[model samples]
Target: MQDYLKPTEIIDWQHPQVLSLARDLAGDRADSTAIAKICFEWVRDEIRHSCDYRLNPVTCRASDVLEFRTGYCFAKSHLLAALLRANGIPAGFCYQRLSINDDGAPYSLHGFNAVYLPEWGWYRVDARGNKLGVNAKFVPPEECLAYQPRLPGECDFPEIFPEPLAVVIEALQAHQTWDGLLKNLPDRVSVLNS
Candidate 1:
């Protein structure tokens, strides 16, 4: 919990701009859940998904995401975590392996978040922004992830991380363009059969 709230190189919740935005979004909200929801929606809608918009330059740092107004799932998750932590809510990264197009082949790692609410313990949310077929919500007790594993071998990784995975950060830093980053995005180390 302390690790989740503390500022990190990637999460960087303590950045002046990130702190300011968090204060603005969660303004006067007494409830942690309410504050978390406010922060989550702002990141989901305000920041455009880089891959979705085909934007270039992979933004990894939370401040960079705020400045560019765009990032991939991993970068977006960093921003969301920063916002929540800035508001004093514990937030962490979560990942899932999804088969593109929901098909049973060609999988890639997808990023989201897990927030620890005092009342609810911990809940997951995807701030990747909504699309025609994908809708992620801030509801608790029930996760409204953008995509669920439909294939027998696809599954969500339940580890709630204090910061972005090093492998993910390295992958983002290795590419200058979104297309390159998307093309060689990280994959799960192993798949679970369910």
Candidate 2:
């Protein structure tokens, strides 16, 4: 629990700006659930998805995402994790391998978060901005992830990690530009076989 809340090199919840924004978002919200909801909504709605908006020069750090108010799914997850942790909720990373097309081929890693609510244990939520058909809400004990596995190879990686996976960070950092990052994004992540 402490590990999830602690600021890391990437999460950086302790950064002054992050802390300030977290406080602002959770304002007048007493319950942990409400705080989590507020933070989740703020991230999901306020932060524009980089690829969706076609913003360039990929950003991986949580603070950078907040400062820019734009990021890819992975970067957005980092920001959500940081915000939740900054507000005293335990938050960790989760992923899914989803097919880019309907055929269930060309799968790639998609990022989201699992937050531990005092009453509900760990709950997964996708703060990826909502569009016409996508709506991710913070409902404990009921999962509403951003994407559902529809094809044969598509699946969720259920592990709740204290920090972003190194492979994800490497992939984001490897590509300097958004188009390049999106183009070369890992089609597969080397998760341990269950």
Candidate 3:
């Protein structure tokens, strides 16, 4: 609990600028779903999507993305998932393969998030900023969870996770560097926002 309270991780919880926000926001949420919903709203609406910081992949942390104010989808997932975890909601990463109409990158896959909703079970959400860096137009609907990523056999998730993740798993299986597998999309929003 103390670890998340550090000035760095606070942004991952919610809007850092709000006065007297925590006691009210995190204190009385009716259920885990509600808390997760608020978290979804904040990340969904407030954080802008960009590819900038994600290039290295390893540097991602909820604290870094929230404090710096920009990140790729995975960073956004980390931020939201960390907040959900901090708030006592069990959450984890869920991703899928999505190739661009025109292939240009290394892997033909995309990443998103999945949260344990208790009564409703685990659900999905995409926090990636718009492909063109437009945050306003990309709002995730509740139905997005219908599209889920493959889960690992070791993972507590109900389904099986796919190949892009398999490349990561194989490297991990070989005791190779897991950090090399992640992609940092790109971003300039954090700079301009700051």
Candidate 4:
């Protein structure tokens, strides 16, 4: 969809660095699926997750995420979307509400991307950077996201947003450090009720 391909303040796929990286990643690959996989893996492996690495200067926009090479899960999604859109592939944002500690009580939004593939339609992928227990891959028609909703409060959101949620952007902009963002991670119920 044109809506998913268009650049925005958060997606910012038209930025020089993003454009260049997309071009570099796509590199002589004519297949959209292949190009999409390359871009997804790059973001998933190359970019550092803020909380996992305890990195600072929280980033929101796609350019800033790529520039700093670090971002929260939501911010990382922005970069992945930008990269896919840069290559003329349609991409959009998706979210999941999960227990912060895999226990109950605290639940927050986890963000990832859904890319439109010609044969498989829109497929969801998580570029949140893999760790010891987490592994996300780009296998079409079969999603392998980093985290699944297992707790009672946790749920997988069905909508694919053309733009990053306002709450996500606001939280990223408001927090200046990894701990700050972690303490105040955005929740989905608030967004739904409002």
Best candidate per lDDT, number? 4
Give per-residue CA lDDT, model 2, range 7-107, as digits (tens): 99899899899999999989888799889988999999999998889886688899999888888899999999999999999999998888766586677
Using TM-score as the yardstick, the better of models 2 and 4 is 4
Candidate 3 local lDDT, 121-152, one digit each (tens): 65666666544433322223344432332333
lDDT of each: 0.88, 0.87, 0.47, 0.93
The TM-score of predicted model 1 comes to: 0.95
Which residue runs does candidate 4 get wrong by more than 4 Å? Answer: none
**lDDT score of model 4?**
0.93
Candidate 3 regions with alpha-carbon error over 4 angstroms:
1-27, 52-59, 101-106, 130-142, 145-194
TM-scores of the models, in the given order?
0.95, 0.95, 0.55, 0.97
Q: Could you give me the TM-score of model 3 versus the true structure?
A: 0.55
For model 4, how does the per-residue alpha-carbon lDDT over 1-56 read when each residue is reduced to its tens digit? Answer: 89999999889999999999999999999999999999999999999999999998
Clashing pairs in 4: none
Provide the lowest-lDDT 10-residue window in model 3: 154-163
Tens-place lDDT per residue, model 1, 94-170, is: 88888765767677789999999999999999999999999999988789998887786577888888878777889
Q: Which is the winner by lDDT between candidate 2 and candidate 3?
A: 2
List pairs with backbone clashes in candidate 1. Answer: none
Residue 27 C-alpha lDDT in model 3: 65
